[model samples]
Target: MHATTAIVTGKPGKARPRGGMTKKRPVDWLLLALVVVGAVLVIAPFYLVLVNSFKSPVDYATSGPLALPETLDFGGIIKFWERVNFPEKVWNSILIAGVVSVLAVVISMLNAFAIGIGRIRGRSWIVLLFLMANLLPQEALLYPLYFMFKSVGLYDNVWAVIIVFTVIQAAFGTYLLSSVYGTFPKEILEAASLDGASRWQILWRVVFPISRPTLSVLLIFFFIWTWNEFLIPLTFLASNANQTVPVAISVLQGDRLMDVTTTSASALLGIIPTLIFFLIFQRTLTRGITAGAVK
Candidate 1:
């Protein structure tokens, strides 16, 4: 009363513009429509596989892939599982892919450390060599690798696949990681050096830890690549006991007459494990890729 106070009658709230709600630009709506269309296109094949996989052969033939299953059929799945010795194939794939991923990443990191951080002489030439290795098709080396493995009594062994893929994958990884490590922040290295960190200590505790996200992406890629490798694994892992999942799928079709439903069921089984793996590591892959975009 003494200071001429002003009374506020209405509740405080955000003021709307003179017009009603803002209208979205036409470009925005177009982009949204395009995204929806792209998503549908990408998802359609998986939808067909899933629907057909659960249908009986007769149901699949009658209604086609676009139609929903008349009844859920475990028959196709069970038949493929038993005939292919699916468990053994899965175990073999896991063993090979796991080993290759670790070995390839480690080998790549060491090579990258030397080339990028150590500043080895002729580093450009070395990188170029690795790049060339990637350009060479797998088919080109198949015969040589086949003979080499066969001569050493490692043929038909999971180790053969593991060893060959480790080298192949590491070549590309080294080419990639060298470029990444080359751009390492000098300030961080200087700080670590001032802290009395030896090169080995820095590699393990400082550099490796900082580079973990990129390495995780590489590890995931290596695992998936090795798991899906068909020709090399098919040739190297001859026995049913040693064959990987992809080899098993091919072998299944070659061994018997598979109806469309059975084939779809096998394809579905083959994809589920890899899809689960990708989903689990998806966040890590995204983070790794985006990490470089920011500071």
Candidate 2:
């Protein structure tokens, strides 16, 4: 019996039936192709910008837009950096976005904690007001904000941009985070309370730790939005010294039209910080967005 069993074990197993074995599907291949195409389309422009930044004007004009630079050239970037005072502009954007993101996320978290789980009176009304604020077009409030900032003498001030951006982003942040906070574990809250934690303590120690993922998403969004914003900075930060990266880059466009290569390099430089930030926080961002979407 042992010999017979060993003989059977040495024999190769029979192949699975055609029905039992899965075959590659045409639909799966098609979906994969589509995804690849979409990725190329999204990345193509950035790749062009990166390669052409090192190209000479002659190289850019004569070669196709997608063509690689014939020779490495740091001259264009160096020239652009010097001409626009790129360091100062980059710093301006960083300062404004950093402050706005931190302030906006904190403010949003406080508001969401109050209305979401606290079940304070008129919660519906409060949520409705936030929705309304989000619904209003930026253009609709453009002139009003402009005049208000001007009247208060905050125009052309970094803090002016920080304050306005914080308020605008905080409203939207609260709207999203309210969903997350509302769905927070009741068990955890009860445990915290029974542990003799005050509402403020629970909010800071318990809720904040749990909601870190949500906060990361909101902070990234606020930073990106504020960093890329053009219209508000264009209007409010009229002075060259106070201009953010977007506004500064626009000004560079006018001054450097004769040097398109340098202009391209400048654009690439201006966006590098944002790209690095997104790449660093991308996983957390995806998780936070999907987590917040849960019912």
Candidate 3:
């Protein structure tokens, strides 16, 4: 019997055992090559900055931008970091982005929750208003805010920038959260209501906790947006002390110094937080950013 079984198992025409694994489809290497090429193109600028940031200024100017540095250089990095007071600039950006993120999330959550739950008489109209408001370009809104902030003596203050960005993000945030909440199982919310949970309690305890991933994505987006906000901060904040990293870097690179290597180092430093945020919370971002981005 054992010999017969072995002969059957080894038969040339017999189907092979899967060993508990699903059969994989043949890989499309052409598609893979295209994707790899696209990824390289997207990452190329940052890669160039990283490599060239280490080259000496003279070497950088003399050599091809794409070539690897012949000798490592730290002097430019140190000088730029100190001259720009990079740490202070970083701190300023963090403070602005942090505050903006929190405020935007809170405002967005409340507005979305109200709109999503349909507790209002004109819910659709309210949502439409928000969507319309969001559609207005920043440039269209900028001058009015510039005038308002200037009138209130908040024009040069970081708070001015913070307020503008928070409000802008809040509109989008509301749209995002409302879409998510609209899909909630009605029975669960009904059950919570039957259990004597107040609307506020339901929102804070049940909905908020459940939507942490979404909120996290919003926060990350807000941080990145405000962190790299250049034109607003540049126009509003004229002083070196008030400038965020992007504005600071731009000002330092004006035609006077013309120091390419140090400017690259500064830019690299400015973007470190953005990179770190992406690396750490990439999975979380995927869940919310995509949904929010689409509509």
lDDT of 3 by residue, 166-239 (tens): 98899999987787888877898899999999999999888888787789988988999889889888878877
Ranked by lDDT from best down, the candidates are 1, 2, 3
Clashing pairs in 3: none
After best superposition, candidate 2 residue 8: deviation in angstroms?
13
Query: Across residues 1-295, which tens digit of lDDT does each residue of candidate 2 receive?
Result: 5556557897545555567867669998999999999999999878877988999888888986788888988878988888778889999999999999999999999999999989889888888898889888778877988888889988788887888889889999888778778888899999999999999999999999878888998899899999999888888888888888888788878873548678779889988989998999899899988876663
The TM-scores, one per candidate, come to 0.89, 0.88, 0.86
After best superposition, candidate 1 residue 118: deviation in angstroms?
Answer: 0.2
Best by lDDT, which number? 1
RMSD of candidate 2 to the truth, in angstroms, is: 4.2
lDDT, candidate 2, equals 0.86
Question: Which numbered prediction scores highest in TM-score against the true structure?
Answer: 1
Q: Write the per-residue lDDT of candidate 1 for residues 108-210, one digit (tens) a residue.
A: 9999998998899999999999999989988899899988987999998889999999999999999999999899988888899999999888799888998
User: Which TM-score value belongs to model 2?
Assistant: 0.88
Clashing pairs for predicted structure model 2, backbone only: none
In model 2, the runs with Cα more than 4 Å from the true position are 1-21, 283-295
What is model 3's C-alpha RMSD?
A: 4.1
